[model samples]
Target: MGSITERLSKKDIEFIENQKMFFVSTAPKDGKINLSPKGLDDTFKIIDENKILWLNYFGSGNETAAHLLEDNRMTIMFCAFDGEPNILRLYCKAKAIQERDDVWEEYISHFSTKRAARQVFEVTIENVNNSCGMGVPLYDFIGQRDDLTNLYNKMSKEEHITYMKKKNLVSFDGKDTKLFED
Candidate 1:
């Protein structure tokens, strides 16, 4: 059985804080769904009872930003991979904030990452679901990979932006991410 609530309780917040990784899911009105595994230090934050922030690093795809632009609905899921079997899910609407935006620095300050961020997703939680994840297999977290960050840090600022424009400006479905919009 699962319990649904309108906001995160103390227990829920604690569970989220212990999590090393989470999944972000989004979809356009009518197209492929995007589910991404997000894991990095200081990338997730609880802004309040109903708001959260996810610091998104540049990735191979920009489906999340594109989908959020088309439809704000999104879901974030965190599972206990090393402790008691529990799952926490947040159903929400989200918006993409890029570096060009005025609030970018404010949001970027929330994270500590060497990789250049592609966007910061501000998520408004509409509902929360907590459940026993009995079916999920447990895995030992060896460590966080530094390959991505190291690779990104090798490039100059301009080169990094160029890479993003070339590879992350559009989703696989051809939807524009509005990553460079004024």
Candidate 2:
């Protein structure tokens, strides 16, 4: 069975902190929905019972940021693949703070990434829910991958900026991500 709550309790926060990865979902008013798997150390932070922040590294698509521009609706999900059988969902309204934004530095400081972050998603949680995830398959825990960090380390700042301008500026559905545009 599933249960809904108004806020994230301490136990909930602890569960989030222990999870290795989570999925972020977002969508425009009318278009393809975006669900991304995010995994990296210190990539996510629980700002409070009602707020959460996650660092958005450069990727092939910028759908989440673009979708946020069109609509604030977002959902984050975490499933326990070890020790416990629980799945948690956070229903939220989110805003993408791009690298060019004034407050970007503040949020970026929460993460330690060698790769240039395209944006930081700030989510205001509206509802919290948890359900038994007994059906979810368990997997062994492994160390994080360094491919992204290695690639970013090789690129100069200008090259990184150019790459973001080219690839992260637009969503798959033709929506602007506002990554470079003020």
Candidate 3:
């Protein structure tokens, strides 16, 4: 157990900023928990107390968005490397914004990546936690994954839409994500 201050202090936020990737987890009222690892400059905005904004570049599934509609609870995690040992996790509720949303341009402008990010999730943080990550191994930062970058570059909007329609519309459990239909 840890105190909230011990969980997401300012220094802890700094540590999280250094991470190139983080895991996002969410679930609907009744379904499998969605845990997806995000990378690159897409996962972002360490906003003030009780607020977080993360960009979701194109992915194989829209589990996060789907789950959020059914339920808002979520978790974002960061594990340290090349620095002090700590594991930080933020527990919160989240809302998803589509590209058509009014604030889409405002939030998308924050990141430089050009994947035409599918959604931005604004989280209402409820608590923060930090703990000794004795088991987490230190690794050197290489760079962002170029394969994904090139993937979108090679895809046309029509093709991307088709792919999203086929893969991103539903969770593995056959639950509707409403990402494409939305």
> Which candidate leads in lDDT?
1
- Candidate 1 C-alpha error for residue 42, in Å: 0.9
- Tell me model 1's lDDT, rounded to 2 decimals: 0.90
Poorly placed runs, candidate 2 (over 4 Å): none
What is the overall TM-score of model 2 with all chains considered together? 0.96
Residue-level lDDT for 90 in candidate 1: 96
Taking every candidate in turn, the Cα RMSD to the unseen true structure, in Å, is 1.0, 1.1, 2.0
How many clashing pairs per prediction, in order? 0, 0, 2
Better of 2 and 3 by lDDT: 2
TM-score of 1: 0.97
Off by over 4 Å in 3: 6-8
Please list all clashing residue pairs in model 1, or write none if there are none. none
User: Which candidate achieves the best TM-score against the true structure?
Assistant: 1
| Per-residue C-alpha lDDT of model 3 across residues 7-30, encoded as one tens digit per residue | 356777778778888889998888
lDDT of each: 0.90, 0.89, 0.79
RMSD of 3: 2.0
Point out the higher-scoring one by TM-score: 1 or 2.
1
Pairs with backbone N, CA or C atoms under 3 Å apart (clashes), candidate 2: none
lDDT of 3 at 23: 89
